[model samples]
Target: MPSVPLHSSATPIVSAVLAFDVGGTDTKAGLVLSAAPGEVPEIVDIQRFRTALDAQRPGPVLVDFLDGLLRRYATEHPQLRIAAVGVTVPGLVDEQRGIGIYAANLGWRDYPFRAELESRMQLPVSFGHDVGAAGDAEVALGAGQGAENAMILVVGTGIAAALYIDGRRLRAGGYAGEVGHAMAPAPDGGLQIMEATGSAGAIGRRYLLAHPDFSGGAREVLTLAKAGDTVAQRIWAEAIAALAFSIAQAVAMIGISKVVIGGGLAEAGDELFEPLAKQIDQLLSFQPRPVLVKAMLGQNAGLIGSALKAQELLSAASSEPSTGALP
Candidate 1:
């Protein structure tokens, strides 16, 4: 049987949640309706906007873009009232205070994103880390839905992981996940960092640089290996080994029951997961083997997760006992 496509609907919920997944180059926006705690929520509307966060005034530029989007959403769907908003952004985020502490690519520091959105739309808002939000989405509706404990490692241009113990997220001052940045002995036996040698992005770049004759990219590297390119094969093997090393160590230390991987590199499918699982199994002698799986949600996981977080905030605000605004 073929997989069914999830179609967006406009069914009204007790409270509607508007979500945004802001990235370095693009921003994804969506709305969740008819949501509840632990419910398999659905996105009512989803759209994307170009966001060149690499510019200088990324905050104001993003602010204007969001402002326009919100107004358009309201005008297009006059029947649905947005009860709350959630925005997930890359970089070090202080979600508790709704601040984007530092976004290297976006050039943001101590950005008050939640306040800006709330003020503009006069609605409650929530903020979250991009990878962490995606991880949360996986835990709620993807691979870790029924698990007691789950670790979601997002392997992309960079690496990060989200730790879910029980139903709650673990935010260690908003810096709990930075797996790619973890320093490891350089594969070349030099002073290079772990990510320089380990991440899927690094693997692709390394392979391409070493062999200009080969087209560059993760998929290209996999193809080259399949065609028996010795260097490509060695690079691919080392990349998988590095990931397995990191994951194995994480399993031993965190006692995670399930691991879901997402990101650009994860696109290699079983080519990446099968080898990773085997390597991890071989490496971990005493630790229990955690089930490793690909993320059910694709690149849009962050957007979906942000929508869920917004939905939660919306529900919370709608149910709270009324209190008069302080003069």
Candidate 2:
């Protein structure tokens, strides 16, 4: 139920792009009035609001929340006309259709997001998979920039990845990069789920569940392992091993030359990267070794990516001759 403030300006009206990074817990919105390519979007403003996505009817809740945000944003910058609006959401998105196919976190299915928002806001809209958008932002502006072949892995509430090959973003029906759910060979000699064993949330949760007395994050687990906490050490090592397996698989398949890791778990820094690199290195002799690096954009990657998408859409809309929807 929060509202943003509007500001009035006498300056000549300028084209603007609005981008929203809609998450289960929080929503980030940015308004970029103008900027050149390769320059940071001139952010007029950025705001974050709590998302009530836990409601039984999350679709409407989210829609209303977005509408309210946009309304406030528009009210503030009435002089500036919006060229495009880009929304990034977590789910199996139909980017072409601008529909939220299925989001377990948001409880949305087949929602016609693009048409709905366009009708409500009366502007061009672009939709993208949340993580994929983040990957695009990274490749275009952050850690993966200039890499011909690279992968961006974000390990947060869940594990998701984005692939960039030769400057083209790969989207295999919005199902291309789901590395977290991939089944991994258990380092403990049993089948283990990748996210369950490798994600930062999973690593911390598993350890805490097993050892209620321990208090810390994935990094603490690694520290405990170094100090001889058998259970902690085992879980930490297992997670690293599982991660390496996934990276090596990606390397072999895509011939990825670089891998950028981000998200909450990635905060472990060398504790995560060094060990993961070693494991992946030891696994393959001839397969080209992918340079593993941490994500540079951090939490803002999604917002930045969404803004870039908005900018791209705005640019595209300016060029394409407008016509009625094609059957």
User: lDDT for every model?
Assistant: 0.78, 0.82
Instruction: Write down the TM-score of every candidate.
Output: 0.87, 0.88
C-alpha RMSD by candidate, in order: 6.8, 6.0
Q: In TM-score terms, which candidate is top?
A: 2
lDDT of 2: 0.82
Q: On a 0 to 100 scale, what is the lDDT of residue 44 in model 2?
A: 72
- What lDDT score is found at residue 208 in candidate 1? 72
The window of 10 residues in a row where model 2 has the poorest summed lDDT is 318-327
Worst 10 residues of 1 by lDDT: 7-16
Prediction 1 global C-alpha lDDT = 0.78
Q: For candidate 1, lDDT tens digit of each residue in 38-153?
A: 66577767888887453677677677777778778777776677766778998888888888888878898887888887787677677889999999888888877887778898
lDDT by residue (1-327, candidate 2, tens digit) is 776557544667777778899987788888866666766566677888887674477667677778888888988987777777888999788787888888887898888888888777777777888889889888987899899889899987688899878777777777788888788887567776788888887788889989888788887887788799899878988888888988898888888889999998788788888889999998887988899888888887887787787777666656788854311
In model 2, pairs of residues that clash are 6-76, 7-76
